[model samples]
Target: MSKGNIGVTTENIFPIIKKFLYSDHEIFLRELVSNAVDASQKMKTLSSVGEFNGELGELKVSISIDEKAKTLTISDRGVGMTAEEIEKYINQIAFSGAEEFVDKYKDDANAIIGHFGLGFYSSFMVAKKVNIITQSHKDGAKAVKWTCDGSPEYTLEEVEKEDRGTDIVLHIDEENENFLQKAEITTLLNKYCKFLPVPVVFGNKTEWKDGKEEETAEENQINDVAPLWTRTPSELKDEDYNQFYKDLYPMSEDPIFNIHLNVDYPFNLTGVLYFPKIKNNVEVQKNKIQLYSNQVFITDSVENIVPEFLTLLHGVIDSPDIPLNVSRSYLQADGNVKKISNHITKKVADRLAEIFKADRADFEAKWDSLKLFIGYGMLTEEKFYDKAQKFSLFKNTDGKYFTFDEYKDIIKENQTDKDDQLVYLYTTNVEEQHSFIEAAKNKGYDVLVMDGQLDNHFVNHLEQKFEKSRFVRVDSDVAEKLIPKESTLESQLSAGDKDDLTSVFSAQVPNGDKMNFIVAFEAMGKDSSPAIITQQEFMRRMKEMSAMQGGGGMNFYGEMPDSYQLVVNENHPIVERILADKNEAVGKEADSLRSKIESLNGKRQELEKAKEGKKEEEIEQAQKDELADVDKKISELNTKKTEVLSKFSTDNKLVSQLIDLALLSNNMLKGEALTKFVKRSIDLI
Candidate 1:
């Protein structure tokens, strides 16, 4: 027996590995089984090259769990180490047999595991002691036994004759005794070695007999030596890929289509990417894609491996170019990883374009499921946007799809405003905005259904790409002003009448910084509703973004009241009748008060102008005093105006009813206010 301390620069290595890597301790099985696979594959390579003149028998790896003894063993039939080879590879820290094997069979050792050389030491992660029983295939080489107790010290010596392979037995500690179960070991093997190059066997197949499960006549193999990704695309059928998807995600609905990736140059990448049918909440069907490296499962967190948007896809991606042990942030900075990301993005774009060009009807059939993913990709990646514009479709409410240029041609003439800006009218909730959609349709305009969670950001992206184009919600403004053409109409009511009218309508709606009521006159006909509410784009966007982040229960934007444009059509007969009634009831009294208010307003304007260019604190005291006087005069006139308006609100139920009608249309009338409106409608009728 010979032993020496494992060479390490720091004593913190073991503790660091235990503490930091504890979260991923289950990966220890993958590391140990992978090492056994490496040894098996090495012997095959040597035999192919005439170096090892020996029988290359069954190369299957087997793992057995001994619950009573708390032992988990990984056995393999491959090029095992001799006594001396054990000292150099197993005794020294970080030294790996895969390195020597790769050097000997440089071009033929497919899927060697020596890149990081941490596979062997992964045993220390869970085992209190590990034993290796290996016999080299080299003629006259004796079988060897190597043992270590979670430390640098190891014992190795010639053992009795045995098979030409290795079996690593892990004496699982009390804390990790759970690994002794068949299910636990099976799950870890499936996660890490299900697609490895070598077929791995766990134990004998079992049968339910005599009221119990008993080992069958055959060995229970746990993995497929080669998965669908490593196969030739020509050899694979559509159903084969679909079956593979089912294997990856058993419960997922069938994917719309798949991208078979088999790249040789730049960096070897072999995998299949599928576009799943994603609906409503994004995470309902998550973790559909399983990431692998040379058939070894590294992680499912492929955010940095693939673009953020691509995570919505369901499939497998195996690329040796990605490192095994590192944070996602590191992968983003690695140069090769960036190239891989760019390549995948281009491949996805090209695949979609091909499908769109070859058979658009079939592609369009899947558009609803495909729309969110493409839109999200275009929104997040600038290059994807550039490519997507060619195939990215615009679907009209009539269920017709069009490319950017095609849609622009169809709507350019009718949707262009006086300023020559092309407006894209869209509706997020088709049912809720049905009235607005119908109005736009009646005017011979097309409305798009842009309702995806990312559509807000996507529409903003499209605006920047399409020259002279803007996306407008169907109800952003009244039908006529939505695409304003030759628009200008002055209000005819007197200043006092305008104030009284505003107060009469505004008194019904809640008043706060959030609940703003912008009183505007429109030329809409008498048939149009007397009042309408429209949200401003900027404030609405802030609120929508706040919803996306879910930053807190309710953010500042959420806390702010609803902002609405209280549009009152001045051209309608109802308005003419109201103004005429005001004149007859308070014409003389309002004219007298209006004269006083107008004089004070002119003085207030003069005072504001005098202080416009002055430093905030440097304004003259008299100027401040004069502004106060003007403010008081305006306030007094406003008081008299409010009294008249309050009387109007109490008397004219039609005004309040009209306001409620608009609020109902916008789906904003809620709770007690809604209840009041229902009761008032009965009384009015």
Candidate 2:
């Protein structure tokens, strides 16, 4: 036996490894098993090159846990290290300066072990002592045994070993006794080695018999040597990919489609990405895309490797180009990783385009499920947006799908307003906004179903992308005003009459802290409802986007009360009769107050026009005071006119009934107000 200190500059290497690497000590199994796989693969390479004459038997890695002994052992049938090789690879942890090495690497423990050929030493993190017994494949080579007790000291000796492989025994520390359990070992092996290139064996297979699980003689292999991603895309069928998706996510719903990624030139990348049927929430479905390095699971959070939008996809991505152990900044800055990301984005876009061009019916059939993902990509990535626009579809309320250009061409001639701006009418809820949708259809206009969770932001994006185009919710404005082909019909009511009408309807609008209603008149023809509720498009969209984005910048808009325009249709018979009744009820008092208000307004208008181009001192203080007094009188007269109108309007059941009908159509009437409307309906009948 020959014993010497392990070639480490620092005496406290063991403690440093334990202290700093405790966060990721669980990956110790992956490192060990990966090393075993590397050895097995190297043996195959040597045999292929005629370097080794021996027959290469079954290559496998096995893990065993002894609870009583508090030891976990990993054995591999691969090229084992001899004494001299062990001295060079395992013992010598070369560093230029002891103190400097500790200072720099003490913080980045994972980087030190993963990138510095210190994989074997990572065993010290969980084990109190580690022993290696090995026999090299080289002819006449002596078997060796090496031992280290979590210190700089180690022992090396010639040993008797029957097998031409290696056995690593880890005496699990007191704090890490969990590793010395069969169930724990199996779980770790399944997680890190489930898709490893080498077959990994845990223990004997079990069968349920005699009311208990009984171990069988057959060894339980825990890994698949060849996973689906390693296969050729041509060999894979649609069901094959679907089955693989099920294997990856057993509980998730079936994905709409998948994109197989296989690139070779700039960097090696092979994986399958599935467009899962994501619900309204995108954040809940993230971290499902598992990233692998040479079939070994590295991480599920591939945000640094893939674009933020692509992270919503599910499945596996294996690329050897990305370093397994490096700083996040370094991984992000890697040229090959950037190329891989760009390639993936390109591949996804091309695949969607191909599907859209070849089998548009099928693509449209899946559009409801596919739109959320595409819209998300367009919103987040500019490059993806540039590509996605070709295939991104606009689904109309009539269940028809069209590309941006196709829809634009179809609506360009008719949907263009007086300003030559194309208007896109959309409905968030077909059922809730059914009346509004019907009103739009009656106007010979197409309305899109922009009801997706991301559609709020997507419409804003489309507004920026499509020249001279704007998206208007079907319920956001009266149909005639939504896409104004010509100037809208003006209300025939005088200013005083309009104010009285506004006061009449506005007083009956249901009270709520979350919403505000403004009374206005629209000539929507006699066929339209007496009253219709319409929210302003810009403010409504801002509120919607603020709710989705939840950003501080837009929170004010989100928190502000929702305001809607309560448009009274002037052409409707009910509104005409209501005005006639008001004119008879108020008699001549309204006319007298209106004439006096008009006289004051006429004087104030002249003073405002005279003062516009003049210096501030040129206007007397008395003139300014008179203007203020005139405005105050006008407001008081308007208030008196409203009081007269309210007395007549409030008593009229038809006024409240008309307002209730609009509220009911908007799905805003509820509780006592809805109950009162129902009771009022029965009484009227």
Clashes of 2: 0
Candidate 1 lDDT by residue in tens digits, 1-685: 5556666677667666655643577878877787888887887888887888767778888888888888988988888878878777876666756766677677887687655566677677788888888888888888988887865566776688568888888898888788888888888887888888998998888999999999887988878888888899899899999998888888878889999999978898889999998885677555566777777777777877788888888888888777655211134358878888889999999999999999999999999999989998888899998899899898888889998899999999999999999999999888878777887898899999888878888887788888988999987788878888886655566656677677777767656775777777677755666677777776776678778878475388866777778888776677777767767776677777778888888888888888887897898788888888889879989799777666766677677777888889988788998998999999978
| Candidate of highest TM-score | 2
TM-scores for all predictions: 0.91, 0.92
Candidate 1: where are CA atoms >4 Å away?
3-23, 209-214, 283-287, 326-333, 488-496, 512-514, 550-559, 580-592, 599-633
Superposed on all Cα atoms, the candidates' RMSDs to the truth, in angstroms, are 3.6, 5.0
- Model 1 TM-score is 0.91
lDDT of each: 0.80, 0.83
Q: lDDT tens digits, residues 60-95, model 2? A: 888898888888888998879889888877888732
